[model samples]
Target: MEDEILGKAYDGRLMRRLLAYLRPYRGQAIVALVATIAASALALVQPYLMKVAIDRYIAQGDLAGLNTIAVLFLLVLVGSLAFEYVQTFIMQMIGQRIMFDMRMQIYGHLQRLDLRFYDRNPVGRLMTRVTTDVDVLNDLFTSGVIAVFDDVFTLAGIMVVLLVMNWKLALVSFSVLPLIVLVTQWFRRNVRDSYRTVRVWIARINAYLQENISGMSTVQLFRREAQNYARFDEIDRGHRDANVASIFYYAVFYPAIEVVGALAASLIIWYGGGRVIQGALTLGSLVAFIQYSSRFYRPISDMSEKFNLLQAAMASSERIFALLDTRVVVENPAAPRQAAGGSGHIVFDHVWFAYRGEDWVLRDVSFEVAPGERVAIVGATGAGKSTIVNLLLRFYDVGRGRILVDGVDIREMELDALRRLFSLVLQDVQLFSGTIASNIRLGNTDITDAQVRSAADAVHAGRFIDRLPQGFDTAVAERGATLSVGQKQLLSFARALAFAPQILVLDEATSSVDTETELLIRDALRVLMGGRTTVAIAHRLSTIQDMDKILVLHKGEVRESGSHQQLLAARGIYYRLYQLQYRDQELRAVARTDAR
Candidate 1:
């Protein structure tokens, strides 16, 4: 589990990058900005109107003048409310659109990334990037950024209005401005660090919860519930402490603003009241000075809150950009060459590979499978059997040497065209939650219902599929939890058959089925492998006995290559493996006979 890297409080580079996403929605953003300025100007008008009403109508007892000022004030109030609503709505629309684009771009990039990237990163952390990190950016767009403009405009407008009315009194009312600035700056500095802590803890909590919940069954099976709960509580406590620290900064800052506001108001009354009495300033002007001063502090306080949001959004943007900036290790060639033939002739020319640098998993392993031939790779658990499949599929590019498909170097061929040559069925069959037919078609609309059923029938999966309540239309649970292991394997075969690839790769496909189901699968395999080049990774010696060729691997090197009887006579790695499996089966049979 990796911790987040903390960034600068105000990163100009990141801000510029974030603004580029808003370029497509420039029209909406401009409209929202105009609405913000208009609303702020409208709000500024009411206090000035009040000043006029007092000076021209209330003191002189002019009834018509008072009525007129009252109507103007009411009109400005209504207009301000309407413009504020429009600004908020437009900003929200822009935020949602930007979020949509960002999420789609991130998800699409993840799909193109090599398997090596996924092997290093966790699903939970990536989920946070697409869901929670993107959401924080949305808040910045909808509230933090636009509200910043509104606050500055409102504060500047009030300053200009106060000076024009009475510079001396305005200067007196502005006496508390220095203290407010000092307090806000101090608060921003402290809260920025606190907010970063909160964001980190949030990511940690998400990672922990996702991993534990996903593996809950394993936790229960091992009876580690109490210990797991204690670990989770420790993580959760750190998150709570982080939040409390941020709350403390907010608690101190908001009240500090209120105190500064009251002090400024008191100063204005003391200075403006004596001036009014001395006949230098009118009562209305004195009252208006107080109103403008309060207005000034309100924006400052609101801006303080927006600063908190900005800090959190900045941290999230750093993480999001880091993900987007990751270079795709495996990419298609710019000017790709085509394969010579479409017969699925695969040749590994001394291939070498590793998930990470220098620590090799496959070391100078070489083999070839001719067109329409069946080849089986037998190896111990960590003997690089699956690495062969991974490298052939270009999941991770070979660290050295090259692979050829149909006489063309795989690196020179387009990735999509290279992958389309083979149909892969893994040890763990992944079936989505959809109908049996949909699972067989697997989002390729070209695979018709007739084709799906024919493939299912060919693999003998149609027998069980037809017996279901809705036949092929029956829905599968997530990962096919509702189906048995053999049933899932049969559906996988149906899927591979429906795709109709020239080469078939099976990674321990029949290792998990029962004896009866294995018989069914063996019969199906004959039909499935008919005239198609097949490469199988098998642990069971009986399954690959009739394969056209056998490659025995030990510690990432091929030690033997021959037919079953031929390898047995050679008395190498394969012969010892056969003897071990045979002896184990014989012991199981003897035990069963004694029990009877």
Candidate 2:
């Protein structure tokens, strides 16, 4: 992912890439640029104005002339300050707009990404791309880009005016300039290198905090609080050390550059003073040249500090763009063949798949279910049972062959429309923080309050739901933390029923519930699936025994498929699994009674 966001310095094309975002704000940007130019021009006046005041007003003081010159200088000063204020405000607003717009674009791109991307990347890393990386770009917009322009314009303008006034004196003031430029370059290099290190350490600190918080329960349960704290301290210390190292460079270097600047100023006084005594320069000219020297190195010293900010932004821009650039591996087909005709029937024809390549979990698997058919898939752990359901939903595309719905390949259909046609309830039973009615409404937004209550009662969730603090209006916590696992599963059933899908899939939906609740849910589901095609994958064989068909899967192949009585009579894989589960339950029951 980092490779996706190029971090190896500014890509010479950054101006082009960055300008693309700026294009929409060209009008505002032009206004800000014009303001900045006006600000720079006003700033150039003070030193020359001082030169004029010295040569005419103060030196050969006509008292009236002195007062008028003073008024003019004050006016220039106020105007300069006003322009600068406007410039800063406008630039900051532009930066914020850019941040807001690009952040929305990045967030939208993330939504388009496939689930496989989430499985590959951590949530914390993705969040850093959104938050930390964007913060970096925000700094770039506010200061990095604009400051560079401000310094260049002000620096160049001063150089031109200084030479026009007195070229010889300008030369004298600039005698140490080459040395200062070299030193500035050297310092900038060191600061950038140090800042890059600081950015890395900061990311490490964020990652550590994220991981520990996410696993807080495990940390406490393992009784390793001290150990975890020690580990965090170690990471915290590394970030602290990097930050301190960066500060050390700035603290020592900025003052050192100032000393060199002061030395250059002293030389400007000595050399220009000699020229004035020789009748080669004037008092005003010498003064203005001295002012020029001060103005010259001010930007140099400030830039040394701002260089660190630029490097930090550069580091962050890399990560943000990387995420923005990543294309989801699963995408709609090009020149898509429209779904020919689907009557809600499904066919998995010679399908093959694996999460990772080479190690196949499902191989040339073939199956078909007619409309309104009820089939149960039975298998042990790691038997590729869930893969079958995942394929049907097109959560993944098949490695070979195709999956068809209503005799049309699903990949050719619009993904949202295709998935919306079926209702799925899995063992995990995930629910976001929302009211009971709101959660059910997700299955089909058009469902009414009456429909919601009816669906809830059908799944037997109504038993404990009204007992909730606000009944159907009771808000659930994240992942239904406020509800028990059985309650959550039943809510999922209610939501599923609300969809009224042409096909229903229950993958271990009753695996976590009590027997009594499971029986009630099973009875309701039996009624719900009456006219709908149903595919059930359950750990216990009892609920699925009455299905119209039961398919036994092993090593990604169907070992046997038949109804309950037919599989039992055949004495095949399904028969053996049934006997094992029920026989163990019988023994446990007798043992419990005897112990009592």
Candidate 3:
């Protein structure tokens, strides 16, 4: 629906913001503008030269003068071509530079936006803003903005030449102008609607494709390939039909302009030919009027096309600026305080938060982790266990109360400095496309090859890395698709270890791996947790039995807090959780023994 709103064809405010991108390239834009004017002037000269050659040289049987005028005509043609090339090349280069600058700005803004923003917006829609919408603005810069001057200058020059030659014939030529206006208005209205439809369907196509491709494995596993294909075909067909309808308007518009031009030419010939017979107009003048009349319609047609470009650009700029203007709900402090280093003490002082209004995900959740202490948070689904971890890392700020690190409110510290103090590993490991070594270091130049291998070896990830032909240099596919789930989890651990943060946060980090892999990781966790303040969130109660403290949450509130034995002795929420897992494990053991 947002895509369907085309807004105005020429919005002054949007145009100003779009023009700001040109500020850095104003010099090149000026050059292109001057070249465009020069080219238009040169084009106007060609027809006049025809009049001069016919009336002064050819009519008087003067071969020498005719030859001279022909040479001048050739020179004018060459000059025009050169200026046209300069104008086109310069504008194209400026467009490309603007696109680069805009994309960088958009991506930087996206990175700064809080997680809540991502929770509301879809990835496919954002991708359209960066890729498709930016491309439409590029067309405006290269073809619609500065190049419009050529059409205006040519149109003005042609009108002046027509009136100077013969006012009566010019009036006859101008009679068709009203018809051009009517046809253009009709074309503009219809084309704009079709263009909006095209944009909407394209965005839908993009969103559908991104969703299906990312979930292709799930679709295949469920045997829903045929259903998904049918859905995609429907979306693709909508995009195609919208485009064809837009093409239909274009197909009718151009030929209509040509027909009107031909009518103008016919009027000029009919009226001017009689005047020549009446000794009021020269034959050369009549020929020149015909040429000028034909040239005049060209700019009119081009301006109509440019109008469509301007309209499309206005719609695109609206979307882009909306995204850029989204206020960052979580922002760094203006005068940020430095986070105290070497101490990972964190405290949540009666924090309250919600992803939506008043429906709290976490309420009055209070806890603390002293430096070098290990804490675990356990809860049922939607029990606010991970919300506590999210709050500590400042992914989303608390609505009430505050979170502190090292006795200073995290809101008072620079975002990057605060986040650098902790390394996070989640159940779903996210690996980018790169060599195995690069994924571990993640572009941190200080991490050396020795450090990378040591981190992998410490976490037992090197076992698989060494098995690969390229070892640490092996390339990883998108999302680490080439690696097993356990292998990916190990690499994630290696990554966190390589970063060597003062605090470690694991959100169900080992849940995806096998029992053998989990045992290897449990062994490595002893070394990883030593001397580091670690916050672990887990559904498996076995993993956190030895933690210094355990917080049990239920329905957005902490209901129990103690060591494993203390909570088990009380026989409350934590005791019930332990009993459930213990029974499940016993049943699994019995089943395994019976099968043997």
Candidate 4:
């Protein structure tokens, strides 16, 4: 949750980097610029027209020109307003479109980043880049860049008009411009800092809130609710302080500029009146010079505010570009590599892997599962049991060796196509936020209600599902909280059945079920796994006792591989593991009998 850009908000290089997004919307942006130039040009004519009307009609008695001049002035005003509207509308549309495309690109990039990125970065921080970061871009384009264009043209035209009318009065009036620019730029810098602080504290608050709410149950269980609330209060107060400081700067900015502007106007009037009385300058020209002075520095005030928004946007841009630059490590082969004969035969030739390349988690692991045959992987904690499955699924690639499916290297196949070949029931079943039937048919568009019911029946889950109020359509609460652990496992079983995959993987599928329920589901699993390439990771050795072959692993390598009776006769690692689970089962049965 630490601030990513607290010290870098005002970096010129970083700010310039953000402007790159404007390139894509350049065509419409040009139209907005043209509109602004037209509007500012039209605005500069008003002051001169007023000067001519004052001296010509009143002093020279030229009343005949008034009606025509008034009509032309009205036309200019109407045209200027139309151009202003079009400019604002078009710039806003272009900015919004850029934001839309930027979000899509960032989101697509996020999807491709490896899972390890999420493990390191907080979700709240990433969300800030999308929501608040995009909002800053909106402000910069609408309220910042557009204002800069308007101010530049208006000030330049006004300065030219002032020099043409009376240079002496213009010189005296603009004496205060230096102080105004200095004070306004100072205020803008401070405001940008305060806003940066505000964004940082807000991200901290979001991170704290997300962690607290998602782990609410753990806090209650540990009686740490009071501690979490106190931490939240600290984060909230930091955000409030940052906000109040930003407001203080904004409150002082406008009034300070007003004082400076009024001072300049007073000096203009004092010198211009003397010149007019002495016949050094005409009254009409002196009046026009005063108007020009007012119009020139008007954009200074605008530029000050726009600069503040630009700084915040640059901070956001840095984070977004960083995300887009992340490289996706997993990719399909350049040329398609299809399975040979498509029988789903799997072979691991000396597979070895480590997440960080620091420890040898899986070492020289080799096994082969024939098509339409069943094999079980058995190991203790940290024994590379799940690692094997992760490799097969390509969640991570094997570091040292080749894994082949149907005589073709799995790495050469498309990730999605490879995954679609298998139906998996993980030990930790993840039931999404959807109805029971919908969860079972995830990503499967062709699964019918009848098919869903059959899958449920095959797993012996229909009994409990049929008892529910909504039956197949019943909503599973977040992570299936409303159902028992066994019920969730049953739903996972039904989901796997619906996939009808060529290869089936069941990782401790019966561990959560009660003995009675387990017996029924075990029979169902046996039938489902029949005539498929089945790979099972089981802790309860009994579940795999009837598997066609068993692989017993220790540390990172396989210690034994044989049939159930063959491994038992070896009196090795598999023998000891079988003996342990068998003794535990006996003890559990005796305890149940004595209690009854």
Candidate 5:
């Protein structure tokens, strides 16, 4: 929908911002402009040289002068070609550099943006901004912006020559100027509408493809292939129709310009011929007028084309600037306090938070974890369990209360310093494309190969790693598709352990692994949790029964807090949850016995 909104063809505000990217390469851009001007001047010389060759040498029957003029004409052609190459090469190189800088700026800004921004924007749409929209601006830089000057110069030079040579004939040639303006306006308006449609469909196509491709396994398991194909076909058809419609405008516009140019040429011939017969205009001058008339319409048509390019760039720039201008809701303090180094003491002082307005996910939540204490949070789905971890990491600032680490509010601490205090492992492990050892180290050069192997062995992940052909050097596919869910979880444990953070935060870390795999890591979990503050969120009560403390969350409030055995004796929410799991286990046991 944002793509559907087409702003002005030339927005001064957007133009100013867009030009700032060119500022860095201003020297190269100047060189390119100079070359463009030189090329335009050289091009104008060729037509006049032709007039001189015909009128002065051929008509006068002077063979030597004709040969000299021919040599000069060839030299001008060569000079023009040389200047054209210099201009094109310089502008293209500058465009690429600006594109690189802009993308880096965009990606860096994206990295600094808070999670709430991601919650509001889709990955595909943001990707379009970085890739597609930036590409549109690149075209403006290389082809539209610098090249427009050449057209303007050529048009002006041709008009001045025509007027100076024969003002009456030049006036006759300019009679069709109004018709050219009308045709260009018609083309620009229609093409702009079609271009907007095309942009909207492109964004839709990208969003649809990213979603379906990422969830292809689900689509296949549910046998929705044909239905997905139908939806994709519809989006594809819309994009195709939008392109074809734009092509129709282009198809009509160029020919109409040619017809208009021909009319101007016809007028020059008729008017200039009469003046020549009456001995008012020289034959050489008449020929030059005809040649200049032909050259005049070309820049006009090119100017129209550049106008469309300018319009597309304006639309693209609006979107890019909008993304860049999005205010970071959660930001680091200007004068941040240094976090006091200790063994992780966290306190949530009556914290209140809502992702959306007034729809509280965590309400007046209060808790504390002493140094090296292992605390477990248990609740139903959507009971604000993960929100606790998110808040602890300062992913989103709390709405109404303060979260403090070592007697300092987290908001007052540097973001990197605050987040570095903990290592998080989630139920869904995100493994990038790299080797097993690289994924473990995660670009942290301080984590040597020995440390990587030790962390893997501590988590019992080395059991599988050793059996592989390449061992620790084994390659991981995208999202670790080559590994089982349990194996990926083991690597995640190894990765978290290698970091050696002061706090270990596990949010449903063992929820996806099987019982055997979970058992494999029980001792590893102890090793990871030993002498380090641990906060684990688990749906399976058995996995967290040995935790130092367990906090039961009901709805958005903390209902009870105690050890597992203490909470079980009270017979409240924890007891009911335990009874339900106990019943299910009993049923499963009975079924196994019957089968045997």
Candidate 6:
């Protein structure tokens, strides 16, 4: 876990990749840099102006010169404020724009990635990539990168002015520099590891919180509240402890620098005061040396904090680049075939597939469906029924053999174009937060409200939708929580119909709805399936009795295939399944008679 939590503190490759994202905002970045430099230069002016006021006006008792210098000091203060404001504003704009670009890029890449990628990663982990991980980079941009330049320039300006003012006093103030370096190095080493720990714990916290909130119903139903809370407490405590550890290093480092800075100031005062008394240094020069020394340490303290942000940014960049570098295993062919409309000639020839190494889910499976044919595949759980649908949709490429639509290999077709040929309704329906009409139309603005209403009405979803206060404009809660299982299922049917694909695939689509809703869905299915190539997976054998062909699969292979009556007459796998389901009444009657 520790090995996974931390990577190299600085990675050049990751930094280069991160810098590429900034290229688009280079104009703003350049402006911010210029502003920071101007600001730093202006910052040196006030101390020098004070020195001028003390030496040329106060010592000579020239009231006019004193008043003029005072006004010049205020002017330099305003100039410094303006430059600082511009620097901050420009940096924040660049940071926000870069963040937007990164979030979109990550989200877009995620959408293009095949299902296999999602199967391996948790939702919370991906969410972190787009949100928290990107946020860390924002700090790196605003405070870590450009601000480092600001701090360095300010420190350099102070050093130059101090050395020119009085070299002996400057050397005395620089005496504590080696100690500050040593303390900062120690703080950096400890804080780097602590920050890694904090990030890891926060990721864990996000994963736990997301999972528990999503499954809160299950936890409550199982009375696992106490156990879940204990688990959450453990994770939350880890996060707190990691943060506390990081804070501990910061706490130590800041005060250590302050003490060292005070020591430097004391040395400057002691040495420079003696020089002034000996007439070796002006009194104004001694005061200016002390002011510059303090200013020098301020930047050192700031750079120390920025160093922490830099380290955290390095880690975040590593994770973000790693995600971006993930190979898109399933890619569109360079020259895709534009197959004619789904004359729905689908053929799976000697196909084999596996989610992981060598553990085949579908082995040597072969089948064909001509246009406008309805085929039903019956199987127990894990018989690879849904794998067939997955392959047809090109969600996962087969490990062996090929799937063809209209005599062309599916891998040769553009994914979106191929998917457009079929409409799939799964056992579970997913609905986003939107109005009923928008949900039906999805993002296709070309699908007018009239078309959306027509599809919903055809699917019998319009009945309940019409009853709602807002009707088609009614808001859908997340995952359609405001809608019933049956109502949501109807919306799924409406969605599929709205697309009007040539092939319709149903995976136990009505399994969760009530009997009344099932009748309405069956009616909609009949109308939707008409003149379309249909593949249905059903647990209720009665529903598929009228299908043109029925394939009975036991494991990964087709054990039997024929019409409903013929397969039953064959007295094979299909026969057994039918008997088990439909013969229950007869068997129960026989048992009752035997008991009498």
How many clashing residue pairs appear in each of the predictions shown?
A: 0, 1, 0, 0, 0, 0
Q: Scored by Cα lDDT, where does model 2 land?
A: 0.81
For model 4, the local distance difference test gives 0.83
Task: Write the residue-wise lDDT of candidate 3 on 1-596 in tens digits.
Answer: 57568888899999999999999999999999999999999999998999999989988999999999999999999999999999999999999999999999999999999899999888877887999889999999999898788998898888888888878889999999999999999999998888888878877887787888888899999999998899989989999999999898889999999999999998888989999899999889999899999999888988998999998899899999999999997899999987666599999899899989999988898888999999999999989888887888889999899999988899998888889999998888899999999999999999999999999999998999999989999999988999998888889899999999999999997686788999988877876888899999989999999999999999999889999999999999999999999999999999999999
TM-score of each: 0.96, 0.93, 0.98, 0.91, 0.98, 0.95
Per-candidate alpha-carbon RMSD to the true structure: 1.7, 2.5, 1.2, 2.8, 1.3, 2.3
What is the per-residue lDDT of model 1 for residues 1-596, given as tens digits with 9 covering 90 to 100? 34355556678999999999999989889888999999999999988898899988999999999999999999999999999999999999999999999999999999999998899887878988999889989999999888899999999999999999988888887888899999999888888777677777877788778888889999999999999999989989999999999889889988999899889889889988999999998888888888888888989988887877777778889989989999998899989999876999999999888777888888888889999999999999999999999999999899898999999988889999999988999879999999999999999999999999999999999999999999999989888989999999999999999999999999998887899999999888888899999999999999999999999988888888988889999998899999999999999999999999
Worst 10 residues of 3 by lDDT: 1-10
Clashing pairs in 4: none
Ranking by TM-score: 3, 5, 1, 6, 2, 4
Best-to-worst order by lDDT is 5, 3, 1, 6, 4, 2
Query: Each model's C-alpha lDDT?
Result: 0.90, 0.81, 0.91, 0.83, 0.92, 0.88
lDDT of 5 by residue, 1-596 (tens): 78667788899989999999999999999999999999999999888998898888988999999999999999999999999999999999999999999999999999999999999998877988999889989999999888999999999999999888878888999999999999999998898889889888987898898889999999999999999999999999999999999999999999999999999988878888988899998888888888888889888888988888898899889999999999987788999998677569999999999999999999999999998999999999999999999999988999999999977899998888888889999889999999999999899999999999999999999999999889999999988999998899899899999999999999998776678998987778888998999999999998999999999988889999999999999999999999999999999999999999
- Residue 29 lDDT, candidate 5, scale 0-100: 96
After superposition, candidate 3 runs with Cα above 4 Å error:
none
Query: Model 6, poorest ten-residue lDDT window?
Result: 1-10
lDDT of 1 at 293: 86
Question: Taking the tens digit of each residue's C-alpha lDDT, what string does model 4 give over 474-507?
Answer: 9889888898888888888889888889999888
- Which segments of model 2 are wrong by more than 4 Å? 1-6, 304-314, 334-342, 443-445
- Could you give candidate 2's per-residue lDDT for residues 1-596 as a string of tens digits? 35223254555465467767778888877777777778778888888878888887788977898788789889988987887788788888888898899889989999878766787898878887777778777787777676777788888998899889887767766777777777778777776776666666777777778888878999999998999899989888988988888788778677777777687778878887887799787788778777777888877777766666665666676567667889866676665655554456888899888888878989888888888899999999989999999889887778888998887788887777678779999899879788988988774558999999999998888879999989999988887878888888888888889888878998987787787878887887886788888888988888887788888898888888888999999998888899999899999999999999
